[model samples]
Target: MLTLDDFTPVTLEDRAFFLDLYARYPQQHSDMSFVTMMCWNHYAHYAYARVGDGVVIMSVIEGEKTFRGPIGPRDPAALEEVLDLAVREGCAAPYYVFDEETLDWVKALYPGLAFRSDRDFADYVYLASDLDDLPGKKYLTIRGHLNRFRRSCEPVVEEMHAEDLAEVREFLKKWCAWRHCDESPVLAEEKEAVLYAMDHFSDLGLSGLMIRVNGAIAAISVYDDLNPDTALIHFEKGLPDCEGVYKAVNQEAARLLAPDRTYINRESDVGVPGLREAKLRYHPHHMAEVYVAEKTDLEKRHQGRGEI
Candidate 1:
């Protein structure tokens, strides 16, 4: 009997509830993180419904509603109920599966159901050591770029502090101008999302690093623990004034996090060709794959059992 009415909008007040659930469930994807949900809530219109020991998340984007599988202990009955609700109320690609274990169970439930691989949303996860050290021939190009940047810029790296928020904001304005964020709807949304994160940095439990060139902030990376073994970079921005500033911020962040975390999730490329190529160059340890079940596929499965 779970319905849209049972779902509540994601807000700052719900952070603790989500953190608790996520601690117990341990999510693999960045999208499942509470900070991501809150920061992008305006654009995604996120909501959740608590069912039994689990919570089912739903997001409305561009007027289309899509649901993610429950984030709690594996309970087949609870999952089926959510799936039924998604079929009745959600868009074409109604349900998303983030991990392989859930995908396996969902496939078992409906042997004929088809799940589409969402390459655009797949998270690129890299070994912390690989990014921190740049030790092998595979990283020769990146090492060369870093060396060139260091020789040219002599960047001073520092951990971002509370007082740095104002300067960070100014840096973002400059970055937006360089990227022409105002001209692109997607970039504008991203600007808003990152600003929201910075505004609530402490509240969201975020840590970051800034690369300073000539005592001015040129690049910044905001991140937080996604799980015991992984750190997720929520926002990484750099000014084009310094070549390879982006790589500098990225490497510094990885070096800072590598000691404690095993992996660094740079998040998804959102199907951007250039961004995808850039992430692929890092050589991900593995992709935290995302899969979605189409409404037609779910309907067909239900129809086969005369249950729809």
Candidate 2:
């Protein structure tokens, strides 16, 4: 049986182990990515337990513990162990399913079990071409914004380097000030996560692009490959000094990734209304959906099933 003791905190040392497992399983959601977990470790408190050919991930946020379905080969035994552990530990949400395949597998095992979709956590995935080309009438408004920003700012797009980390940190300070990150707990946590990523930029194998408007960095985007055909943009920030600097950075990041990747995952909106609106304006190709099983629902069906 899987126990809390079997789980260990996620750290840089486990990078190779996770990369190997992820290479075999290939995750669809940004949260499953090793870099995302490592960078946000301070906020999410990620830990994992290896189970057979798979691994079970758990996170503690504000003292609330949650577990995710095992990520690896399709092994019913592994799934049962995670479910049992979640139930025994009394996690409010028994466990989470981040990909459709895992959801289906869980449903197959317990046909009576109920799962709830978390719209706030659903990742917006876009065709790399759509973002890069801004084609058709759907993108007309975005194209106008991008064109106007280019005309007004004459922004120069450059790839981020190790030497640029200091400048990037300064830019982030200005951005945090503009956004009043200190006023909100969530934004403060995000600021910490971003800074952690920047601090370990090279160690995390991250690549990014920066937009310089009149010799000063106005916007920046950091991204890395999530899978063979998908690139995940982990952090993006733009100062309001430029009217459309955000749009410019968005398109520039797409242009940099489109040639090699088929899709770009901008991650979840976390129920932020303004953030959701901005992401939707890009017109996602599809959402990499997420679902969770409530403890009550799990207890109802599997309470007495000693093994499950």
Candidate 3:
């Protein structure tokens, strides 16, 4: 059976393989992206093993071991094997079901499993146009803020270049200092992850915009197309050079990436109150709800939850 020992660490070297596999399957959540697995591997400790024609990814996060996928195509036997490994590892909730569709598939196969919604990690999905346009009365405040930002500082959103790496690093240092990232483990790890993504921008297939105000770099966004119809913004950061700068970079990134894509996934808020409010303000087209499944009688669990 599959086990952690059978898996290998996810790294830059496996980018092409993972991206190709994900392209065929088309993931809805950004957390399952290869870029995410590699960049945050230090904190998330991602590992994977080939399962039939597809692959299975697993990670141990916050002292809990979890499984994200048998990512390419559905293989019942392979999935069963992975699930067994999860239980053997004593994972309280092993499966990290990305959406309802995945949960449905798993349930149809297993017939009796306990699954619970994981609101903390559900991805906020938005129409690419909504972010670019900021239309209607609801967005009036955001639009006004964007306008005020433009009036005070002539902002230019330009394609980030290789030579711009130094400036981006400098900007991150200042940004971290302001946020006191060094004092907190979570922020410190995030800083490390962001730097890794930036450092390997080309290999990671990243496209981003650097927002400059009055000829000085004020904000930057790093992103890539997550699927044929969705683009994912992995990291967006800025100093308090001006309020609403984050919103400006966000809008610009959407405007630039939205031409061919229909949606943009800004990822999860992770139970952060301020973050949840900010993302909610934009009005998501949908939230790709995540669920955690543990080994149990599925029918009983579903009955208790009223067929949810």
Candidate 3 overall lDDT versus native? 0.85
Q: Evaluate model 3: give its TM-score.
A: 0.94
Candidate 1 residue-wise lDDT, 1-308, digit = tens: 88999999999999899888888889899999999998999899999998888899999999999999778877777887898898899998899999898899888777788998999999999999999999889999999999999999999999998999999999999999999999999999999999999899999999999999999999999999999999999999998888999889989999999999999999999999999999999999999999998888877775555332
Winner of 2 and 3 under lDDT: 2
**Model 2 regions more than 4 Å off:** 303-308
Tens digits of per-residue lDDT, candidate 2, 1-308, equal 89999999999999999888888889999989999998889988999999998899999887888899688888889988888788888468858999888888888778788999999999999999999999999999999988898898899999999999999999999999999999999899999999999999999999999999899999999999999999999999999998999899999999999999999999999999999999999999999998989988877765445444
Model 1 reaches what TM-score against the true structure?
A: 0.97
The predictions' CA RMSDs to the true structure, in order, are 1.5, 1.5, 3.2
* Model 1 bad stretches (over 4 Å): 303-308
All candidates' TM-scores? 0.97, 0.97, 0.94
Candidate structures ordered by lDDT, highest first? 1, 2, 3
Deviation of model 3 at 33, angstroms: 0.5
Task: Report the error of model 2 at residue 83, Å.
Answer: 0.6
* Alpha-carbon local distance difference test for all models: 0.92, 0.91, 0.85
Q: Which sections of candidate 3 miss by over 4 Å?
A: 295-308
